[model samples]
Target chain A: MPYIDIQNDLPGIRGLMAFSPHTAEPMGLLANALLHHSDGLLAAERELIAAHVSYLNDCFYCQHSHAEIACYYLDGDRQLVDQVRTGDDQAAISPKLKALLRVAAKVQQGGKAVQPADIELSRKEGATDKEIHDTVLIAAAFCMFNRYVDGLGATTPADLGSYPPRAKQVAENGYGPHIFSTSQPAGPSVKPL
Target chain B: MAHIDLPDLPGIRGLMAFSPETAGPLNELAEILLRDNANSLTRGERELIATYVSALNDCFFCSNVHGAMAGHYLQCDMEGIDRIKGDFASADIPAKLKSLLRIAGSVQKGGKYVTISQITDARTLGATDREIHDTVLIAAAFCMFNRYVDGLGTQAPPDRQYYINRASQRAAEGYLDFELYKYK
Candidate 1:
């Protein structure tokens, strides 16, 4: 159960957002910009990085949700998603992506854990400065997201069946206003702060 | 410094050099987080939360800089701030603040590490729900800031006076008006 009264059926951060829509707006905007914006990295690659970080953090909801999105972008390659989650090094992905995943892992451990050589390897593998920066931000942001979901004691539903359909929606629609358009009214009345 | 050919900027400022466009919004978020008075937490308590998380992350610059800021606001000396950072539980502070620190520490480790019992403990100590909410955001934000500084291998000055000087300035002016690029 959530630490506070929240929508019990909604999974992970969705419940928390339902509890506070005011905060949800900015959070969704940031997610859309980071994961779905059509600029630096491909959406699938960004989702892969997010899933990898979620996997490392042991955030079940985030890992499953983003993994489903990754599979969608990867032409329904669920096995490839599983492989990336298990170990990016062994996964049959581009060398640049593997190098980028290494940087993301370092960000997961701690910021200082990322060394100069890691950046060099990524650059050698054709990753740009922007890609590197986005990778770090994505990894760091997920740390906050994962903590928010679990810190509040939000539920991570055991049924994997629910995630794919939602992931398909999120993947197709992007994280916009519709993401928080739920039947449950915003609860607990978050005071403006 | 870590991997990229960044300009010779000092401290965390150097890391921002990699993505100058992000520096503005990132600094804006910091301003809202640390300087804005919309939340229930006092400026001193908020700064302490940032310092505590920075210390936990082992980011030397952030810990020292925010530690100085925390001391300035609390009217405490370095020794007091050091005591709080060393072991907030035993520090000469209120019980409620200590409970919040406990929550911040749990966030530093991982989100799932925080438990319902911890929330209950905080509530028992007279912490309002908004206080708990702000504490979690502060802890989460510091994780990002700490990573941004340390992830790029930005160099932290060794002299404590460097941070003390910057802290005095930041406390007086806040984070908004300050120029981030000139330091390079």
Candidate 2:
């Protein structure tokens, strides 16, 4: 049960997004621009980064959902996805991704937690400035997202199996239409400040 | 100097310029979150929420810039904003705002840190579901902004006057028109 009556049966951020279509519209766009689009990083690599951050934050829904998307792009490598999420050094991922994850972890700890050496390491491993920037943003965005979902005590499905289906759709279509343009009216009548 | 080769403009301004693709949607979010008149929150109240979260994150640039925006809309001085940033509970503001600030502070600590009592408290004080909803988003969004600004080793000038002067122009211009609000 969510802290507020969001008036939706959808789990996690979906319910929250449905509750606030206004914020959802841009947030969905941000997700599209950040994770779904082609960039210096592959969509799988980007989803992997997002999943890693979500795992660090302990956001079960976000981690699993994005991890499944990542798995879709990584030749369905669930084991590799798990390795990336756990920060296992022996994971088969490239050195550039490992370096980027280090930076992402630091951003998860705090903004200032990311140091000069972290950036240097990523660049040393062949991470571009754009890749580094997006990694930090993805990590930082997940922190907010984790807090939003948990802060509201948003509903989560009891079974992990429930996520992969939605994950498949998310992987196929990206985030915009999935989250935005809901038929539900936005929640709550606010008092003027 | 930043960790990357960002434009010479300081803080998020330069970072956004570096990636126009992400910048467009981000600025749109900012404009709607802070400046939307339909919100029950005054732009000043919403800015204060941003200031409080940025301050808790110890993000000097975000704290000061949004702090100034809060002051600009609320007609308070920098010191007044400082008091709110320092301890919003003790600041001379409405009971409703105090509760909202408390909620935002919990969000700064972590999402799960926000309690059921906090939600109930805000409700008892007359915050609507939308207000609570936006409050969480504002706090969450600032976490993203704060990290982006500092995660890249962006410069945060210590001079308070620069932010203070910029606040008026920024308040008039809002966040979307990135070209108008510039400082190095």
Candidate 3:
């Protein structure tokens, strides 16, 4: 059970967002700006960054759900999801993305943890100035988001399989509507028990 | 010196300038989180939470920036803010804020570090759900911000008054309009 009665059955950050639409609207916009709106980085690459940071933070709901979304963008490449989770640098990704991921990892540890060397590596791999800026911000944002979801003990769907369809919806429509979910799916019509 | 070729603007502002796209919504979020008075927690209290978390992360620019804002809203001087940063537990402030700060402190370490008892204790001390929710979110957001500022190795003005002098202007303007502050 979440520490606060979010008054909904939505899982993870979605539940928390529903509880506070004031924050939700802006937050959803931020997510869209970073992930959906094109600022040079591919949607899949950006989502991969979000998913990988969530994976580092050990937020199951975020990691799998975002991976599912990234998978959608990647034409169902589950292997990238696997490699990103394991922080496998050699995992068949563009060298630029791999370098950015390394920088993201440093941001995940702590802010000061990201050394000049990390930025150097990203630049050497041909990452743009904007990519480096977004990479750090994306990593930082996920750290905030991961804490928001977990600190309140938001619901994590027991069924990990449930994330893909929702990921599809998000990948297609973007994040705003989901955060302000008006249509709560009716409870399980067929009880598992 | 920032690792990236950001303009010489100080702190998070420079980073925001480098990426105006992300900065738009981020500034909106900051306004809602720190300045919106509809929630029970005062702007001062929320700003303090933001400040303390930045201090904990050792991000001098953010700590001082929001610390100045906290002082501006709360009407306490920098010495009081310094005391709160030193150890909020011992600060001369409300028990409710202390409780919330304890929860904020736990969050500064890691999300999992915030125990159930801390939440319950905060609730017991008259913290509404929104307050608890806001506190956690503020802490989380600052972690994001602290990383964004420090991760790029942005420089802070070594003089503390650089922030304090600007607090009045910033607190009046809220978070959305970086243009008004001429931070660009």
User: Against the true structure, whose TM-score is highest?
Assistant: 3
Candidate 3 residue spans exceeding 4 A from truth: A182-193, B178-184
**Candidate 2 residue pairs in backbone clash:** none
Number of the candidate with higher DockQ, 2 or 3: 3
Residue-wise lDDT of candidate 2 within B32-82, one digit each (tens)? Answer: 999989899999999999999999899999999999899999999999998
lDDT per residue for candidate 1 within B110-182, as digits (tens), equals: 9888888889999999988767876887798788778877877778888877777777778867876777764
- For model 2, fnat equals 0.84
Taking all chains together, each candidate's TM-score versus the true structure is: 0.88, 0.94, 0.95
Point out where model 1 deviates above 4 Å: A6-9, A20-26, A181-193, B182-184
Instruction: Give per-residue CA lDDT, model 3, range B63-136, as digits (tens).
Output: 99999999999999888998998988878889999999999998887778889999999999999999999999
Whole-model lDDT per candidate? 0.80, 0.86, 0.87
Q: What is the lDDT of residue B84 in candidate 1?
A: 91
In every candidate, how many clashes are there? 1, 0, 0
lDDT for model 2: 0.86
TM-score winner, 1 or 2: 2
After superposition on all CA atoms, what RMSD does each candidate show versus the true structure?
5.4, 6.0, 2.8
lDDT for each residue of candidate 2 in A92-112, tens digit (9 for 90 to 100): 989998999999999999989
DockQ (Cα-based) for each candidate:
0.57, 0.82, 0.87
